[model samples]
Target: MTATSSPLFRPLQLGPLNLPSRIVMAPMTRARSSQPGDVPNALMAQYYAQRASAGLIVTEASQVSRQGQGYSFTPGIYSDAQVEGWRRVTEAVHAEGGRIVLQLWHVGRMSHASFHADGLPVAPSAIAPQAQVWVAGDDGVGRMVDSPVPRALSVPDIAAVVGDFRRAAANAMRAGFDGVEIHGANGYLIDQFLRTTSNQRTDAYTGATLEGRTRFALEVAAAVASEAGAERTGMRLAPFITQRGMDCPEIIPTILHLARQLDATGLAYLHLVEADWADAPQIPESFRAALRQAYQGRLIVAGGYDATRASQVLSDGFADLVAFGRPFIANPDLPRRLAHGLPLAAFDPKALFGGAAQGYSDYAPYEAVAEATA
Candidate 1:
């Protein structure tokens, strides 16, 4: 592609954020945060700051509360110390001329009994997710174990979760994030409430109605947006196949409903995670078209997108921005790589989880190698 025609290089405006290009660095969980989940260290800051060239950056899913944690060594935004630590990270990114948005999240029943402080894992329903969780137990490190069913939430408890999101948003701003993304995707708490099989409650949050399942998400958006400002707020939704559910008929209407409500909020963007590596069916393409119109703000499409596909989708106007996750992990200069059409480095999947700094900060940028050779 020529310079004038490069979709990766063209500047784009996402809500009030004027991005230098359409390339976005998707949020990825590397489980490399400080131990006991206190804060993100200098190494973490360097990691993000190095990749600041992307048009926009979405930090990994951060636990809004201790109960929101689902994995080991991930960061949190609920505590003062955590916020301070993230402030350093944001400073580093901004110093490098990059903007970042924090992804606020709660793992819900996705957590294990051992991870919770009070030894209690929260969930929308008492039913076990039938999924596996990676825990850190004795004998060095813990492995993937079957996920136990979570306790059903009462009406009052639902209200409390909404408050958690609000406080998390406040903390994100204190930490210097340009924006905040409510984690409504994946098979987490928000997704559990939205899906039918997980949320079988007869309460107002349940039933087959769109208002019932989507009410919780709307509440989160409304609460978080109040703090982050509609132009600085966004959401990530994996309506297709996620650790949540793939083939549900309910996902369509729920997403459509969210787009309609979110459009009115004047949020910056709605990140759609559509993964093709899964074994189940995909989200109907028609929904994307509907969402394209349903949401008036910027739309970011993430997951399994290459340079060619991203450009084509952007040209087709299906998405305003395209986020690359795994590629970003292995290539800090991914935007330049796509622009110059260079081959990408392969990532070590095993090292992607918990690690010191090997896979985390050791990835070399394109310029470093070029300078060395020259």
Candidate 2:
């Protein structure tokens, strides 16, 4: 079949943006942001502009505040410099006729003490994710370190973080992004609050009841949607991810409940991050159907999808878009390559994180590689 005829090439109207294709560039942390302030830079802008063929580009998760940060070089949206830095990114993508959104993030317990002033991460409960985050030393060498137990957030603290999300959304608009995506997945702060394994709070946002567990996520979503306009806001969720101490049996139902609430609030899209590791538990097709029924808005699914699986998911009538993470790293023109059934270039594992433009932006398009080979 021709690339144009494939389901992956289908055009989609998500919120106020009209995407040219269903192929989305998923958010991935490359840890290359400018240091000292964790600001987005011209290099980051160039990196994104290289992949402008995507129907949608969700920028790497940018922390909403210093307290939300979990990694060394990841960018933030709270400061004026960070906003201006992101402006360059938005302008570059827009100049290339691409639509982009900033993923508003708060790592919660998925963080290290080095990223915080108090030398402790904060979460819904005082639990450790038992996971490791990439932390870079003064020499700029990054190594994975074990996560320390975090302090439980007070009710007032939860409200403060919600305001951070709200401010991040507004800053995304000022930066000229088409929208903002709440990073509610991958055992992050919002995900921590939704899971039984992480959240042991006794407050209103406790994990004891479905409503209590879901309140923090819902409130953050509401605040972001209110600031960015419900039509221009999307959120990501990962009910199948069990890593980072997020193995909650009740997560499936919890996410379903949240999906219904998100749908009711008129958010633009819901991105699902399925577990991508080999031997990881497969997300049941039954749950996919349930999510489709629960959320009426556009759906985007990421994790280990090639062209065929992506097309199949779209044809199955559940997902409106498919997000590619690692594939886009080496193939800037990934949509064209997928459409034409071209070979994909493998990315360098060594330079995957905490690097300059070598693995980040030095990748050539398939045509360029072909011409060079000739």
Best by lDDT: 2
Which numbered prediction scores highest in TM-score against the true structure?
A: 2
Candidate 2 lDDT tens digits, 1-374 = 67877889978899889998999999999888887799999999999999999999999999999999998899999999999999999999999999999999999988998987889999998999999999998888999998899999988888999999999999999999999999999999999999999988887887999999999989999999888999999999999998888899999999999999999999999999999999988878899999999999999999999999999889988799999999999999999999999999999999888888998999999989999999
TM-scores for candidates 1 onward, in order: 0.95, 0.99
Q: Which stretches of candidate 2 lie over 4 Å from their true place?
A: none
Q: Kindly list the per-residue Cα lDDT of model 1 for residues 71-177, writing each as its tens digit.
A: 87889999988998899999999999998999999988888887766666787778777787777777647588776767788899889989999999999999999
RMSD of each: 1.7, 0.8
Instruction: Assess each prediction's global lDDT (C-alpha) against the native.
Output: 0.85, 0.93
Clash number for every model?
1, 0
Counting only residues 3 or more apart in sequence or on different chains, how many pairs clash (N, Cα, C under 3 Å) in candidate 1?
A: 1
